[model samples]
Target: MPRPAEAALLSTSLIPTDNSTYEALPLVDSESLQALITHEALNASALELFAIANASVKEYGHPTRVIGSGGHYKTLGWIEKQLKNMSDYYTYEKQEFKALNGMVFNHSLSVNGVKVLDEKPFQLTPAAHVYWADLVVIDNLGCEDIDYAPLNASLSTNTVALIKRGECPFGNKSSLAGKWGASAALIYDPESDEIITGTLGTPTNTTVGTLGISKTLAESLIAQKNAGVPLKINMFIAAYVGFIKTKNIIATTIHGDQDNIVALGAHSDSVEAGPGINDDGSGTISLLNVAAQLTNFKINNAVRFAWWAAEEEGLLGSNFYAYNLTALENSKIRLFMDYDMMASPNFEYQVYNGSNELNPPGSEELKQLYIDYYESKGLPWVLIPFDGRSDYVGFIETGIPAGGIAAGAEGKNSQNGEVLDKCYHALCDDVTNLNWDAFLTNTQLIAHSVATYANSLEGFPLREPPKVASSADVPYKFNLHGNFYIM
Candidate 1:
C-alpha cells in the first residue's frame, strides 16, 4: 500500500539538485542480472499502483491529476513514498520549477442565439467574453504562415476566426487568427464529431482565447459563410492564466558509476480528465516497479528515475530540467528512456524509432534494444515516430540520445481498426482501462531494459558532446495535447 503524504516527505530529504550525493553498492556480475526482475514482483507492483490511483480519486473527490490539484499532489506523495521505502538504496531530490498553467472555470458557445455544445478551452489561453461577432473561415490546413495568406478573415477586433484541426498545432491556427485581429479562435475537428482538448504549448501564445468545437457545428458556420447568411456567435470563457509551483522527483541509486547514468522518466501529472490510469498511471508504476526490483542486484551505471510534472501543459518539468543542465552534467547521462501509456486497453507493443529524425544520435541503437527484446519473445512490435508527445522532448532537444516505449492512445489498433485507448484523456480512463496481459509484458520490458543498461552499457554508445538545438528544430508532432498525443 502507498503511504500517506506526510511520510512521503522523506523523498525530499536526500540528494542535491546539482548531482552531489553518491554511495556505491558492489556491482553484480552482468551475467546474473536477468534474475533481478520477477513476474510476482511486477504483479504486486501493479496492484499497488492501481490502488494508489483509485484511492486518490476517493480522497481528493476528483479524478484529474492536473497541476496544483489535490489528485496531482497525492500522486507525487505516492511516488516519493514508493521510492523512499526502497531499502535506502536511492537518494532523491525535488527539482522545483515555475509551471505555467491555465484553467477554464466555465465556457459556452451559441450561434444565432441557438445553444450548442460547450467549447473546451485549450490550456494556457486567455479568457473570452464576446457578446457577438461575425464568423471568418480559414479555408486550408493552417499549418504554415502561407496557408493563412489567402484567408479573408475579418479585420474587426470583435470577429471570431474558425479553423479546422489539421496538420499543425492548434496553437499555430489560433495564433494566425490572433494575427488577423480576431477576438477568439475556434478549432473544430473536421473529421470527427467528438470534441477535442489541447494546450497552446506556452502562456500567451495568442492574444485571443482558443477553444475546440465539433464538425457538425463548424460545417454549419462554413456553409452559412459560403452562402449569403450572416453568422455571429456569443461566447463566454472565464479562465486564469498564471504560473504554479511544482517539482520533479528524481531518485538516483546511491551506488553505481555516476558518470554514465541510465535515466528513465515518466510525467507525473495528468489531463483535466479522468484518473489518467492508462495514460500514465501505467508509466509511473513501471518506473516504480523497476526501481524497487533492481535493488536486488548492483549496477555498473547509476540509474535515475524521474516523475515529471506539467507534461500535459507542455513538457514543462522535463524541459526545465534539461534546459538547466550544464554541458558537463548533460554528458553524464549515457541514455534516456521515457515510458508512457504502457498499458493502453487496446494494446500494441509500440517502440519509438531509434532513427527518428528528432533524435540526436545513438537513438537508433536504443530503438533496436526494444525491437530485439520483443523479437526474442516472439511478440509483435510496431514502430512509432519519436515525436514530442511525451517527456522525451526535453532530453532530445537538449541533444541527449533518447528512446522509449508506449502502448499508444489515439492510434488505431491494427486488428480491430479502433482507437487504441477509447478512454484516452476521457473520464473513463480508470484502472479498468488497462490490459493486464499487455501491462505485465511491458512491465517486464521496462525492468529488463533498465537493468540491461544499468549492469553495463556494453554497446550503448556514450553520449556525444551535446550540440544543443533550438526548440523549433525539433519536429514536435501535433495532434498533440494531454499526454499520449502530440503538442
Candidate 2:
C-alpha cells in the first residue's frame, strides 16, 4: 500500500470567526494509523451500545431515547459522562434549537363506566378530558366535510369521534373533529392489533386532543353502538405539545490540525416507536467509541464528531449546524462523512454514490475510499444514492462533498430479497437488531478513514468555496413504513 497520511481526532461544535490559522497537515505514518484502528475497541463499544439502547426495554417496555422524554435526556447524559474520561484530549459543546415535540404523559379511557387500559396517546396534541361524552363513530376518514355526513347524531361539544387510521393525515382527523365540535378524538388502526403511536405532525389550533386505541377497543365500542346501546364514555389524556429545547452534542479533538477538518456525525434521538438501535444507535455509538479511541493518536486534519438531535424529525439538528456555517468556516471542512444504520440486521455494504448535482468535487473520492477499503479486505460493497435520507444532505447541498455509509434499513437486499432491517423504526429495534460483523467492519472503516485524513488531505479535492447552505424546505414527516422524508 502506498503510504497514506496520518489520521486526525474528532472535535468542534461550532467553528469560530476567522479560523485563519491554515497550515500544512503532516501525514501520520502507517504504523500510527494502524494502531488507532483496533478490533477490541469496536467490539467492546458494540456491547455497550446494545445495552444502552435496550436499557429500558425490559423495565419500561420500550426505549427511553425518544426526544423530550426523561429517558432520552438520560441517554444524552450517559454520552456526556463517557466523554468526560477523554477530557484530557478532547472537548465537547452543545447546539440548542427550538423543536416541536410532544410527550404523552398519561392516558385512560372507560367504556360504559368500565376502565379500559388498552390505549396509546397521540403526540403534538393537547390534553383531553371528557366525561360521559357521546361516542360518534365517523364512518369514513374525516378528510373532507362530506365524510362526516354519515354521523346521524347531531354534533355537540361532548362528541368524541372514534376514527380509523388511514387515507389522510392524523392532523386532518383532529382538525375535522374541531369543525364538528368534537372535544376529543380516538384513532385506531383498523388493520393491526398493535396499539397505534404517532404525532399529529405539528401543533393544531383545533382543541380536539387525540389518542390512539387498538383494534379491539374500537371494535368493542362499535359493536356496542350496533346493538342500539347508548354508550357513555369517559377519557383522559395528559399530554404536552409545542416546542421543547433539545441539543446536539458536538466534540472535537484538541490534538489534530484544526483548520483542515474531517467531520462524522449520527443522530442521537430515537423515534417514539423504539430505541432506534440499528437505525442510528449503531451510528451514534460507533462515533462515540471511535472518538474515544481516536485520542490515543494524533493526525494532520482535525476531526469533528457530532451526535445530532431530531434527525428523526427531518435532520433538523444537522441541518441547523450546516446551514448556519459562514462561507469561510465551510472552506475549512475538507470532507463531511455520515454513518447511519451501519448494523442493520439483514445487511449490505452500501456507500453514498454522492451523485447529487450540488455535492462538491471530492464526493466521488470519498465514495472511492470506502469502495477501496472494502475491496482491499476482499469484501463486497454496493452503491447507494445521495438521496437526502440522512444528515449528510445539508452539507452536500451547501457545496460540501459529503458521503455516508449504511448497512441498510427498509431498503431491500437484492442478494436475497430480504428487508435490510425488519425491526427498523419498530420497538423490536433493540439489543438484538444489529449485524455484528457489519458493525465491526464499518466502524473499523471509520477509524481508518479518519486516521488517513488526519494524516493528510493529499488525494482529496480542495474545499469548494462555501455557498449558501440549502435543503428541501418541505415538512419532514414519518411515512407509513416508518421512514422519514422531506415530502
Measured by TM-score, the strongest candidate is 1
Q: Per-residue lDDT tens digits of candidate 1, residues 1-487?
A: 1122322122344544442222344455433444565556655655655455554465345567777777788788888877768635788888777777766677888888987764677766688888778777776876666665434434555788788886767667777777766778788887777677777756444557878887887887788888979887888888888877888889888778899888999888877666787778788877887787677666778999999988887787887777667787788988899998988989899998867454667788889989998899899999987656778876777778889999988768887888898888777787778888778778788877787888778866667676454545543323443332542
Query: What is the lDDT for 135 in model 1?
Result: 76
How well is each residue in 1-487 modelled by candidate 2, as lDDT tens digits?
A: 1111221123433333332332233345544544564556655665665566566554446675667765567667778888777676667877677677766667788878999887766656788899998888897767777766644455555778888887666777888877767888888888766676555665557747888888998998899889989988898988776677788887877667778889989888887667777768888878887787676665667888888887776577787777767687778888899998888888999988874343678888888889999999899999986667788876876677888788987668979988788886677887678788898888888877787787788868887677673333322111331122311
User: In model 2, how large is the Cα lDDT of residue 17?
Assistant: 39
Candidate 1: list runs displaced more than 4 Å: 1-61, 144-157, 356-358, 469-487
> CA lDDT, every prediction?
0.74, 0.73
Model 2 scores a TM of 0.70
